[model samples]
Target: MRVASLMNVLGRGWLLAERALQVFHSTARETRALKFNYPKGTFEAWAYMTCMETVSAILSQVSQVTFEDMTSSLLLIRASLWEYGLKKLYKLGEICQLVPTSNAPDENQINRITSGITQQSAGGDSEDQGRLLVATLMSKQQFTSKYLELGEMVIGAFKHAGRKRTACSVGLDMAKFHVELGQIEEAERLLSDMCSLYSPENWTIFSANTISLLAE
Candidate 1:
């Protein structure tokens, strides 16, 4: 049936994203070890650049599907920032070593690199796909703002669809992201706002999770 086929396609996208995440994590660990041992050298620089490429691939794969998946979007944002940091290190190593300048990435270059993946997707909003592809190339400050904006949009979509609990859950996740970024006041305000949506008869888990996060 059409429903089964759609689910299969979605599941395939998620599976690819998940597998990419695993590879990225493993590559990151190896690169970290290389950095710790060599500090600043050709091998370390090479390892780091490779690791970043893997991270970029994960973002590319995720964007090939729906940007509506909060986990994939969050991971891409996090990995984007991490890539920024790693790139700085790579540049620093370039001064002392013949680091691979050819591998240096710019926004346009990354966009081109991911264009094939974006073209492969048969579903999801084109506008949202554009936003996600843009997100993968953004710097830390840019991605943080963009992601928060996306979280709000996704929450609105959930609310409009009468998925109040899902919306509240996403709001909590966004608040947690704020906390992770050390925006404590923003996190507190978000949690407070989300509280107004929860009641005794609904979203009980949201209240408990919000309270637990606030307590932290």
Candidate 2:
């Protein structure tokens, strides 16, 4: 059947429908060519498997594309994961290892995201671009006064755009940075402001994780 039918039935289910469609298309082509013939349902099964492999490869590529999109969009979850890595590195006390490795956030990946943010910020139309820039900067271990100034710029854009969730996130990141710099009162004020503006569900997990760390 059509991919839309699969989507409607499954609700955000991409993998199964993609695989099935791939297999059906391949098998149908094979049948037309008469290059392969099998007993009754056997061909269909083989075709299904072939479709699955093809779809699996496509899905892998799709995932990478999606990751880049999320990074570009500065989605809170993606930013949180990056922040989590920073925390992990801090815990290991190998803060210098924040540079890209062959694994996560390798240097090339960092440069890509950084360049993406710079380009997006220069373009200056989307609130998401600003939020993403803040998230990316916050994920880094070291910051200069300029970075904090940039964080303020992000906060201003989020507020101007009426994005409470993004504003809260920027606030929370500033709070964490302030707390790390021994500016506890400023951090507390920012956290309090965030709590006032955002519901619990809207609070990013990174903020929750930071609270947990602080409580300990």
Candidate 3:
């Protein structure tokens, strides 16, 4: 019910934002009027996107959510963040510091997302990307779980960007993630999928640089 309520609230915010965009703009006298409601609405879609004050209130409620529900909510929140662009994200980071800011302003969205997930996950089995809120919400699952899912999403987008090998490499990383969790069987499955998606020969070559388990 909490998830549903949150979803409803998010949907209503989006609708209001859409209506705001249609709030009407015109040129009067010596001025041009333009209504850009969706922009703010997008950012406002999730109160916590920039709401440090309500973080406790909302998270207090979400803290009790199941891992499945919590991950779903987090995905929705992340989507809202992306809609606002990385520039705004960096700004939010300035305040809460939980949401990350892109240091390389020139990097594409996929790269930025990948870097965030990598930096956070590398710190240990943490899907929260080094943030207490994320860690708590996702505390039940293996830390690498959410990171892997997000990595795959980025890889899919990268494939459309014309870097097939780079895209496939993420799957290898997914396999590595599984290995770290001591899920050898799961890791092997991912590696096998990567080989089928890419090339057996290339997988063999790429296998050398990563952890030895891939070689096994």
Tell me model 3's lDDT, rounded to 2 decimals.
0.41
Q: Using lDDT as the measure, name the better of candidate 1 and candidate 3.
A: 1
Q: Which of the numbered candidates is closest to the native, going by highest lDDT?
A: 1
Clashing pairs in 3: 125-143
What TM-score against the true fold does each predicted structure earn?
0.42, 0.31, 0.34
Best by TM-score: 1
lDDT string, candidate 2, 1-216, tens digits: 245334434543344433444545565687879866433323322332233233333334346565334223233322332233223223222222232221233444345444444453422223343344334434444323534554565565455445667777777777776776677887777777676665455656655654554453
CA lDDT scores, all candidates in order: 0.51, 0.45, 0.41
69-177 per-residue lDDT for model 1 (tens digits): 5464454433433433344333432333223222343545344434543554344433344445345444445545645665675566555545567667777867877
Error of model 3, residue 87, in angstroms: 18
Candidate 3 residue lDDT tens string, 61-115: 4556653564443433333232222223333333322221223222233234334
For model 2, how many clashes?
3
| Model 2 clashing residue pairs (backbone) | 100-106, 100-107, 101-106
Estimate candidate 2's alpha-carbon lDDT, on a 0 to 1 scale. 0.45
Q: Please report how far candidate 1 places residue 156 from its true position, in Å.
A: 1.7
> For candidate 2, which ten residues in a row score worst on lDDT?
93-102
Runs in model 3 deviating more than 4 A are: 1-142, 200-204, 207-215
